[model samples]
Target: MASMLISLSHFCDKHGPRILLVTQAAINGSTGDELLVPTYPTDSYCESCLLHFPKSSINDIRSLKSNIGSQCFVSTQYSSIRYQLLTLIIRRSFSEETMIYDGMPLVFYDDIRGLNLVMGFKLNDENARGNERRYCIIFTIDSTDHTSSMQLLSENWNFITGGFDRMVKYICNSHKQELERQNNVNDEKSNFNLLGKTYLRGNKVKVPRNLAELTHDELLFVRLHKWNSFLLNSCMRSSSE
Candidate 1:
């Protein structure tokens, strides 16, 4: 037990914030592959692997749940992503395990597909089998397809017809340690483009900083701008195809 505790302490100290484990089946084929980014490595496709996000991203994690037009007090648009982003605090470069050590929150984006068959008798339109593509967000505490710890973050009709598939990620023992490491290096240096990637300034690097460089409003604006850009870019690319 003593040795086990030491090992865990080392792991936590070495890798701040828990890791996000994604299933390889979720990333099958081309559609699933595109969801991957630089931080999300695919060395272990069949088995669960870690997902990374900068702790600074928590600035934009200010998501609120809404149930407008929801059938069961859930949600209507299916595009609401409030629940996917958590309120939990993830500190960068923590020496001890924080809230992220016990139950880490993760964010993932993907598409849930299902075949729907319409009755042959109904020929007055809406009778054909509709496309099965849907934008979805699934986050769970454990590494499994279905679990009591699982929560459906978001889902919306894929009107653009782009192929997307399963994506799972959350904070856990597996959360990326490198993100925190890089964040610290950048903070000390105050220079972007560390580790071959651009470190967003202003609100883009919204994580809690010891230096108190940026204000809350500035960070919020940066977060909103980023999300908007990402959403718009995705739609444009898919629509043009």
Candidate 2:
């Protein structure tokens, strides 16, 4: 039994790369909810991928729960025909234990027909802190036949889910580290001190060398002093004249 197991392992190692490994997830898992296709615009094909039948084909694009449309241009007739651009999310998966990473696998129906799919991910960091940041991944699959494309996507469902999950974990950790660095910068800025003091009527105000150190009231005080000095100089010049 041991010898048979060893032989099988060696055989798989030698030939696994040549065979398409299909997992249960790819067979059973659903990519995502199907989006509603608008009928007004006659152009059902995406200008970028040139794939047709938006409602029937593309899977799990954007967050339907949040009212976000699929990343593909075929969301609607107005959207599909007007934009005429293709966007895809390139997703990657990282293994924490192995410290190894793998990118998303491509599903091909016909190599002779040319490229059919493109995917990419985007990070929305504005107004978000660390893990709260939004990461959006888009997959645009294009094919001449809707049935073939859908079947290809279904067969590769496991890869899609695994890639999405791993990428999320990686991004969250990186984002947390970035936030820590930014906080350190703020802490350093807070420790900054002014170089000199401003004296007014025997009272002293510390004049910050860095503009970032200035408060609203301190800024007003500086402006007031400048205006007063300008007025005094003007009066002196008038007297000389």
Candidate 3:
């Protein structure tokens, strides 16, 4: 038996380095006719050996029920479902580890064979204050693919996909909240600019204008200029009198 670990980062830059380890059992001393093992490795592909035999000489490997552990592996019949699950798992794992301080985004995609998972997390200028988080997406064939008994496994895989989708949504919402907070801060700074600087009763700085008047950048700038002139003229008049 042999395993192969393939890194997705080599193929795609958007998806950071993702590892998929494939372990297969060699059949009848032939390398090409190897049976794909059900275990998910941190690598993408792990082959038993490089020795290739004639296709006619190789025999098909029997399938078996999958007994994957509770780790972050995903089981799916549909390639799309598998791709989505793997992407979500990687994103969830990354989010758990790092604090998201910026609005940089992460992207994920499965390889053309649908056997490899790719994940990329990049920090934009907006998120430069945060840590550079890396993401890994992984994919493996459903264990049932090798066996005759696939009905139960297929159903279970579907259920898992549903649960995974819900989790992904939650993560997305968290990112959204971060963006909303950033926007709120920007709005506050903008409002400060629009309200001709005024002093509150407590000596705290205040904006003379309301949010409605300062809602748009264009309107805010115009209002700011008008308010500035008004304040200057009033001060001058009081001093002269």
TM per candidate comes to 0.16, 0.30, 0.29
Question: lDDT (0-100) at residue 113 of candidate 2?
Answer: 29
Tell me the tens digit of each residue's lDDT in model 2 across 1-241.
0000000000011111110000010011223223223334324322211212213255522111111122111121112221222211111111113222233333333322222322223232333223121112223333345564465455545654455455434544554565567668755655552223432242233211211111112232223223322322232233234
Identify the runs in model 1 with alpha carbons over 4 angstroms from their true place.
1-61, 64-222, 225-236
List, residue by residue over 101-149, the lDDT tens digit for candidate 3. 2322232223322222223333222321232223232223323233311
State the local distance difference test value for candidate 1: 0.22
TM for candidate 3 is 0.29
Task: Give the alpha-carbon lDDT of every model.
Answer: 0.22, 0.26, 0.29
Ranking by lDDT: 3, 2, 1
lDDT for residue 190 in candidate 1, whole number 0-100? 65
Q: Which pairs clash inside model 1?
A: 18-172, 18-175, 19-172, 19-174, 19-175, 56-207, 106-170
After superposition on all C-alphas, the RMSD of every candidate to the true structure, in Å, is: 21.8, 27.5, 27.4
Error of 2 at 238 (Å): 89
Candidate 1: C-alpha RMSD after superposition: 21.8
**Between 2 and 3, whose lDDT is larger?**
3
Tell me how far candidate 2 lies from the true structure as C-alpha RMSD in angstroms.
27.5
lDDT of 3 at 31: 35
